[model samples]
Target: MDTELLKTFLEVSRTRHFGRAAEALYLTQSAVSFRIRQLENQLGVNLFTRHRNNIRLTTAGERLLPYAENLMSIWLTAKKEVSHTSQHNELTIGASSSLWECMLSEWLVALYQQHKDLQFEARISQRKSLVKQLHERQLDLLITTESPKMDEFSSQLLGHFDLALFSAAQKTTKSELKYLRLEWGPDFQQHETGLISNDGVPVLTTSSAQIAYKLLQQLNGCSFLPVEWAKKREGIYLVPDSTTLSRPLYAIWLQNSDKQSTIKELFKTPLIAQ
Candidate 1:
């Protein structure tokens, strides 16, 4: 089976527009359509339902998605293994933008102190991108707030951190405060729904804790941040009567990976604390 065909199919499924997918793949629209047709001919099924301005995967296409993703992941991993050089042992770690600022930055320092010879790469990306990199074996480890649900992956709890609302102004009421919403994950979102008023809208919504912190200081607004981060800044006080939120951090890695021993060793060190 041609990997390019599968890639094209996946791209089309993602974009839901042949023209956009073609542009992304650097292929002409006709070429993209031809590849999809070839794939359909090979599978003997209609993979997509086409309409005037919309396209969607059929039942057969939906069933094939996971298998195609796994196949591509395996292919990519094989390619990387065959092309690996022996100059130095390389490891790539990925995390969300906020995780990089809050914990990964310190963890990287500790890792290098312990293993000076190891070649390390850190990727700061969105959660979805990090998961994709993990699936493709492009990343050796992932630091995240939530554990991935894939059976092929394993996660260890690093530690929990407290998230509390901080503000530049003192003794402000919830109604008077201009809340800056931080994207911690699903659990935070659920917790926020209860705490935040239905009529209240955030002054700013951001995924980066660093950005939220800076913005709160500049705008004199309020935001929930890691207590560790809040302690570092001056004139930032916890909001009155606000509940402190705790979130678990996890170190995720693929099961039976080549870096399993290294991952286990790293976890054993006192890099992250409760």
Candidate 2:
């Protein structure tokens, strides 16, 4: 099957409009339509149903979407691997911004220093996007607090980190402090709801620790932050009588990943300290 046809099909599927797909692909609208027709003819199925201002995928298209994504990802990876002339081993790692902020950044630096022959590409995104990339085989490894419960994936507990309430105010009660909620994960949310009560909405809610930290400096707000990070920064004091939460970090990757040995060897030395 021609990869170009698959690519065009994917673009049309994404935009739900042949004209938009053509514009995005830098092709004429007729060319985009022809590619889709070619792909559908080869597959012996109608990939999409066309209506006035409404374009929706057929049953076959829905089934082919995941396969198409996986194939594209695999082809891209293969192209890079074949084109690279270097002897160094390359791995793509994905993680949420918070995970990168809390631990992966320091760990990655140490990794590069220790393993000079290894090269890494980091993709920092939201958890959902990271997981989707992992599923499509764009990421060799993913570092996240929540483990994916899927048969094709395997997860190992990397370590745990402590999150404690930190405030810029020298002295203040939990109720008096403007609460800045840093969304760690569902477990953290449940744990926090049980321990703290701010009466209503939080002053700020964010997934980025950096944003929360910046706001903490400017506002008299308290947010749960990594213990080590909170302790290092000046003017960020630990709130008295606030409950500390311990969250587990996990390294997730495909069960049948070709880099299984390499991934295992990389984790032999603990990435994050418990």
On TM-score, the leading prediction is 2
What are the Cα lDDT values of the candidates? 0.84, 0.84
What TM-score fits each model? 0.71, 0.74
Write the residue-wise lDDT of candidate 2 on 50-148 in tens digits: 996699999999999999988887888677656443523888898878778878888898888778888889998878888887787668899889998
The residue-level lDDT of candidate 1 at 256 comes to 69
* Model 1, span 91-167: residue lDDT tens: 88888778788777888898889888787889888887888888777888998889989999989988889988888
Candidate 1, residue 101: the lDDT equals 85
Task: Kindly report which residue stretches of model 2 are placed more than 4 angstroms away from their true locations once superposed.
Answer: 17-20, 26-30, 40-88, 126-138, 147-156, 198-200, 217-220, 254-258, 268-270
| Model 1 TM-score on a 0 to 1 scale | 0.71
lDDT of model 2 at position 57? 98
TM-score of 2: 0.74
Model 1 scores worst on lDDT over the 10 consecutive residues at 80-89
